[model samples]
Target chain A: MAYSDKVLDHYNNPRNVGSFDKSDPRVGTGMVGAPECGDVMKLQVKVNQETGIIEDAKFKTFGCGSAIASSSLATEWLRGKTVDQALEIKNTDIVNELSLPPVKIHCSVLAEDAIKAAITDYKKKQGVLTPEAVAVH
Target chain B: MPPLPRDYYGFFGFDRKLAIDSAALQKRFYELSRQWHPDRFGRKSAEEQEMALEATSILNDGYRTLKDPVKRAEYLLTQDGFPIAEQRGKDVPPELLEEVFELNMMLEEVKSGDESARPQLEQSRQHFLGLREGVDRELLREFQRHDESVEASPTSKQALQEIRGLLNRRRYIENLIRDVERALNPVTPSRPAPG
Candidate 1:
């Protein structure tokens, strides 16, 4: 399937394609994989604790171009967004932005999952209770 | 030739079970192939001839699918409502992903002309191969457990679920092994250039 020019662009010159210090308390790291395709993606975000905004985002992915582009685009959109705003970033939004075909929609979904995972990891580090954690109580 | 069973197991006239005698399956396949050879229907009516062709197609496809243990288990999983489709990230254990990510990083380093990581990759390849052997052994036991259980019983369903999880892990490790081997050998790109 032909990738959208946008996907190709991001794939060729993936933005924020690196990682943050995993041990940093302010850094939230998410590592996720798609077993069917054997794709692994690691996305990280550094939050400005006082301002409650994401100051930086990075990603490293080992998979198809669509997956690499999806996470690349995710990091681009993540910076400057508040943690809550970032949570609102949906997989469909990524799909629409990337013009991903039906078969490649899971790539965008993986990116979205990585975002939530990173945020959750950061929250856990902060000892903040997530909604799911609260619901369990 | 009342429309042969759509399912592979049904097409082969085998009971719905995971543990099958390979020798028996091969014998049955040959018998069916001869029965639906199409030449036998040379003087038959047009519809009967068509049915023979259809059965021949199904038999060939079904035999190929059922001949391999992994393929057979995958087919049974889908038949039993465990499609083994894309697993959600939550379904995968985090530590496995972490390991996969690290191995991938090492592979990239090696691909970029650094041979320093070669020894480590070789070690990892052996580790992953060992992991795959363990998964295969467990899968064998699970197949037996599944076949011994009553069809549609809770035990059968549970076994199927466990098989699905095991298959996912196996697939992950298989990919890692393939990647490590490729990195160590430095062949053509692991994936075709993306379009």
Candidate 2:
């Protein structure tokens, strides 16, 4: 199956593909995986504690091109955005942006899930109370 | 059209338990295959041939899935309408996180053609293989737990949940092993060797 041009671009030149100091109180790391596909994704975010803004974001994904592209797009959208605003970034938006086919839609869902999980971890580190139920795809 | 069996065990006419009689299952599979073989319907009408083809397809799929313990567990979960795939990251044991993280890092090194990482990758492969075997044992216990429960009762929920969790862990470990294998020997397409 051929990937969309955007998907291919992101896969070839994934942005912010690295890790942060996970021990830093300001940085939150979210590690996720899809059991069915054996894909693992780790998304990390450095947050500005006082302002609740995402100062930086990075991801490392072990999966297909679509998964790498989805998470790559996720980190790009995360930087400089407020945590609340980041939550507003939906899987559908990622899916549409990458023109992901029906089977690959779950890759976007995983991306969106990684974002939420990262934020949740950040909130926990900052000692902020968070909702018990975080979305999982 | 008659509705197909909801689970592989039912499809294969076996008892819904993990301790399946492999010899019997194999014999049954061959019998069904012969009955559904397309050649048996060669002189039949087109519609009959189509029906035979569909049945054969399902039969083959059922057999393949039922033959593997892990796949059988996954198939059962799928039949139960449990979003097994979606349960991915959420259901993994929290304690395995650190080990998984380290393994992923090693995988990266291997992927980058770092020969020095081979020993570490080999170690990780053995570790994950051991872990997967442990999970299989747990699955057997859970299977018995479920089988012993009263039929159509809610008491089986705990066993089912445990089985689901074990299956998730097993899947992750299997993937880790595959990664190690791929890195150790990168697959090259088969071609005629140059003289």
Candidate 2 per-residue lDDT, tens place, A75-125, comes to 999999998888889999999999999999889988988888888888778
Worst 10 residues of 2 chain B by lDDT: B80-89
**DockQ category of candidate 2:** acceptable
What Cα-based lDDT does every candidate model obtain? Answer: 0.90, 0.83
Candidate 2 residues lying further than 4 Å off, grouped into runs, are: A132-137, B1-13, B23-67, B80-88, B94-98, B187-195
> Taking the tens digit of each residue's C-alpha lDDT, what string does model 1 give over B8-95?
8888999887878899999999999999998999999999999999999999889888988888899999987898884565567888
Q: Candidate 2 on B55-163: residue-level lDDT in tens?
A: 8888989888888777877777666655466574667754576577678788888787787889988888888889989988899988888788874457576777778
Count clashes in each candidate, considering only residues at least 3 apart in sequence or on different chains: 0, 0
Residue pair clashes in candidate 1? none
Each candidate: chain B TM-score: 0.90, 0.83
